[model samples]
Target: MTSKPPLLASMFAPWPRIPIDTTDGSDFFHLDRVAGSAATGWALGPEGAYEQNLTLAEVVDGAVREALLHLLELGLIDIDSDRLNAAPGLPTHRERAVP
Candidate 1:
């Protein structure tokens, strides 16, 4: 049987490394209810569901970035996806070169 491409191989890659504290909590990005803040970008607060101090401008943007980071670790994202897909798992469109 033909093997899958390396790019597509990431789909089965292991989960990204997450920093967990002794309390079994995250130590990276902090998920907070930034909706309260008037700041155009979302902000993370203490005691977040995820990490504890990662403050992002847009909550959606932050979530995506974090997810991509994890997927990249396991090679889940296809190389072509990044180059071909207008939206490479990101909020914006990342078009590849025509050639």
Candidate 2:
């Protein structure tokens, strides 16, 4: 049987991470919004959901940088679909990449 190329959705889903609102400005990027902000120093982004940030500006910036690094080093290419598919005879994209 032949396999398929992994789709981006399966591996990740859309979720809120930082609680920052440029319009509000007052709230800024409150870490409290993040589910596990106190523990992980990260936010509950697409990779995770309700099951889950940084400062107003610094925190948000840092989070984005970190996420980008993960994608680059891990080779996590974005896909348009909602299902995460993988190439045959290869390890899962997320698993292969490391922090």
Candidate 3:
């Protein structure tokens, strides 16, 4: 029998090692795909400490909207149905991209 690929194989592919810098240039963080059988999601944190998977709810939180918008503008994360449905008020990545 043929074996099927892991469910999140595509979603968890190696991401570009880009750091999202804070507006004040105080610190920066990265968004990474955490692919595992037990848990999977976007990991948002600075290097060395406080790395944690972000849930859909957390991503949509008001406190995180600014960062989320920045991420979308940078093309780090693609806008999809799930995200669109989750945060209907947010603009699409294309709409928010910098000229």
Number of the top candidate by TM-score?
Answer: 1
Q: Encode model 2's per-residue lDDT on 31-90: one tens digit a residue.
A: 223322422344454423223223456655556556555544545434534332342232
Cα deviation of 32 in candidate 3 (Å)? 7.4
Worst 10 residues of 1 by lDDT: 27-36
| Model 2: CA > 4 A from native | 1-54, 78-99
Comparison by TM-score, 1 against 2, better one: 1
Error of 2 at 43 (Å): 7.3
Runs with alpha carbons beyond 4 Å of true place in candidate 1: 1-57, 81-99
- Over the full model, what C-alpha lDDT does candidate 2 score relative to the true structure? 0.38
Model 1 agreement with the true structure over 8-97: per-residue lDDT tens digits: 223344323323332324322122222222122222433332444544444556655555555555454436555345332322332342
Tell how far residue 41 is off in model 3, in angstroms.
24
lDDT of 3 by residue, 7-33 (tens): 222443432232334343332323422
State candidate 3's TM-score. 0.25
Clashing pairs in 2: 6-85, 6-86, 7-85, 10-83, 10-84, 29-56, 31-53, 55-59
